[model samples]
Target: MAFRQTVGKFLGNHAETNENHLDVSLQTHYYKTTKDRALTVLRNFFEKNEKFRINAVSNERGEVSASIIKGKKAFIVGTVIMVRPHQTVVDFSVTTESAFPFDFGYSTKVIHRLYDHMDKELPTIPKTNR
Candidate 1:
């Protein structure tokens, strides 16, 4: 089982876009929640998962970096910024670790999974200030 999982992780290979970097910005989501709250949500989500280990978190800056090693090793870096009162922007970067030259959309899938989690966690999406 462990060997199968490890192989699955290593098989995560990407195409272009500069090797193994996958970055994405969630459509501006306005929330009634504060930046600290958002950061907490992110931290808690990662902390609850045994596959992830948070390396750094800055409440003041609203950014976090975590390492995930379920089958393979990768870093999950994200930022939550307050554009206006009760309006925030969240961006994430998932860089997979693999011996292969590229990831076959595994990194992107990871980001999409996180987005789904956030959507469920923060159900109240307010109108954008912009």
Candidate 2:
């Protein structure tokens, strides 16, 4: 990682998952399930968490937005999209609300924590499976 990127990773309050994420753990994840099912599980995931206050959910847009009030307030958006039958992709965007520009990689850690739960709740499709 570049010096700036290294600094940003620690000094930025925002983190997002995508296909081209520099961090391997931050890469988009795929599950062997329909988009609807994946989204439903995601919705339930947020609903069951008291720290998370769901703001909006749009099935048509394939995204769920929520604010988590833990140590610091943070907004998160999780997206589930279907590429084909029984193949769904999941991604997340998180931004912590803080006076400082950085959150000490808190956003990235949140994504990882979410992915850990999602991997157990949903059947993940390995690269070989796809």
The per-model lDDT (C-alpha) reads: 0.68, 0.92
Off by over 4 Å in 2: none
lDDT of 1 at 121: 76
User: Over the stretch 7-95, how does candidate 2's per-residue lDDT look in tens digits?
Assistant: 89889999999987877889999999999999999999899998898999999989999999766899999998999999999999999
Q: TM-scores of all models?
A: 0.73, 0.95
Find the 10 residues in a row with the least total lDDT in model 2: 1-10
> After TM-score superposition, what is the CA distance of residue 53 in candidate 2 from its true location, in Å?
0.5
- In angstroms, the error of model 1 at 66 is 0.4
Instruction: Spell out the clash pairs found in candidate 2.
Output: 11-102
Best-matching candidate per lDDT? 2
Tell me the deviation in Å of residue 42 in model 1. 0.2
For residues 1-130, could you state the per-residue lDDT of candidate 1 as single tens digits?
A: 2565446444654211221223223244445567877788889999999999999998887889998878777788878887777766666777888887657667767777776777677754644334
TM-score of 1: 0.73
Error of 1 at 79 (Å): 0.3
